[model samples]
Target: MSPLVALVHATPAAIGPARTAFAEAFPEAELWHLLDDRLAADADAAGGLTPPLRKRMLTLIGHAVDNGADAVQLTCSMYGPVAALAGQLWDVPVHGSDETMLRELGWSRPARVGVIGSLDSAVADSARRVAEVVPGAEIVPITAAGAAEAASSGDAERLSAALENAARGHEVGVFVLAQYSLTPQWMRLEAALSTPVLSPPQLAAGELRRNLLEAP
Candidate 1:
């Protein structure tokens, strides 16, 4: 039987890449999307994660739990700590979208980590996650200027072009796409650079598959 994995997303942009990852990497696992754009709006309004924000995240996890999700993953990279706490609370495999990527990069011990994100908050959040895994790692945060707007406007070409531009001229072991919306440009970004690209959606999907389907 296929395990059901619930995906909690703070923005609409994460949905497509997440769904695509599930289809491409682990189609046997049923995918469920729980989107709350207000989560992002409120988080932004508050300037950071607050106690109330934590509670709200827990509530979303609870919803996934009630729906019989065998595992839950947040498509939003900014909520890494919240997802960690949720994993403790739920006794299930709870994961932040970029956690797997962070772990991989940490093991690689890259001296200069490159991060590309659609929003400033995402860039900061991803950099912090990278620091957590690889202490004192030099992080270069680059904003995919106008990429968020292009994504929201449903202009894939424009978003890809913007991310491609933002990712160029970076010398690092790997470039991390801080937002799932940027995953579609992973191959192009890899081609443009001399390093590999780490995609949150792909990594998260593989993590879920490893924990659920491949766990022995």
Candidate 2:
């Protein structure tokens, strides 16, 4: 039997590519994309989740359960509370975008962590991961909204500039791209000549592979 998972996409973003990467890792499960209009909605520069976003996610996950998804994976790293609450409300194996990052952090690093996101929720995700993993490590979070916008429009140059701006003060440090939204242009940003970049898509995909493969 094929296990099905619902991919609740809150933004009008290219999250499918990231999920495809995850799917390649878990060939047995079928992936579904469910999008709500809320993704096009803008975030306050402060980057926190607005009520629109919370409601959006709630509605999307509800739809997923109706569709009979065996599991639900909310792919946005920024929606931390939403991720936990949705997992509990749905009673399934809900995967948060940053959950893998934290688990991986436990296995690695004492380096300064630079987090990249187009939204505040993503910054929070990386900071939370660093806090849980690095312990007293400096976590610098930056938003590449312009980059995200360009990526949606298929402009890699604009995305690169957004990364450059977000790259400020990340000298010689480890960086994590917290939002799956900025994932397409993730490679455009230069963290630090000395720092290694940590990407949520790659991390999340690996996590999905392990879980789906090991689960009985």
Candidate 3:
């Protein structure tokens, strides 16, 4: 039987790209998607993950485990803290999509890490994650104004242009696209800049496969 990997998403934009990454990286694994777009809104309204939101997140994670998921991937970057707690509670592997990518960047000990995100909260949250991984590392967070709305509205070109503009001038060792939803625009951003662009989906997929599927 194939391993079941449950993907938890807080925004619609995350679903397809995450599925695509899993398909490309671990075709043999069974994929399950769970989405609650409102979770993102609530988190934003409350200025962070409120207790109720965290409870719902755990409930969702438990539901996935009960449904026979061999592993769970939190594909939303904003849910990092909740995901970290869930990881602790689950015996199965639970992946915070952006965590590994940030950790990898942190190891480089870069003087400045540029972060671009569609939402202001996501940018701040991502910066926190980076600091957690690399103490004292400088993090520069950029809000890709209107980019999220463009992506959600299916304006890929506008989204691409906004992201490119946000990342155009940054003298950082690496530029990290803070959300998995922004993964598709990675190449466009990369081409227009000299800095390395690190997006979470592909890295998370590879890490999930290695940790959950390939582990003995």
What lDDT does each candidate get?
0.84, 0.68, 0.84
Q: TM-score-based ranking, best first?
A: 3, 1, 2
RMSD of 3: 1.3
Q: 2 or 3, which is superior by TM-score?
A: 3
Per-candidate TM-score against the hidden true structure: 0.95, 0.81, 0.95
> What would the TM-score be for candidate 2 when compared with the true structure?
0.81
Weakest 10 consecutive residues of candidate 1 by summed lDDT: 39-48
Tell how far residue 149 is off in model 2, in angstroms: 2.2
Q: Model 3: how far is 116 from its true place, Å? A: 0.6
Q: At residue 85, what lDDT does model 2 achieve?
A: 85
How many times do residue backbones clash in model 2? 4
Tens digit of per-residue lDDT, candidate 2, span 1-216: 777877777575646556655655566767888876455344434366778777777788888887788777776665656778877787767777677777776677656677777656556656776777778777776776586677677666776678767676666456777766666555545432345666666676666756766768
- Model 1 quality (TM-score): 0.95
Best candidate, lDDT: 3
Compose the digit string of candidate 3's lDDT tens values, residues 104-191.
Answer: 8867887888889988888888888887787877889999988988878867799889998887877888889888888887877888
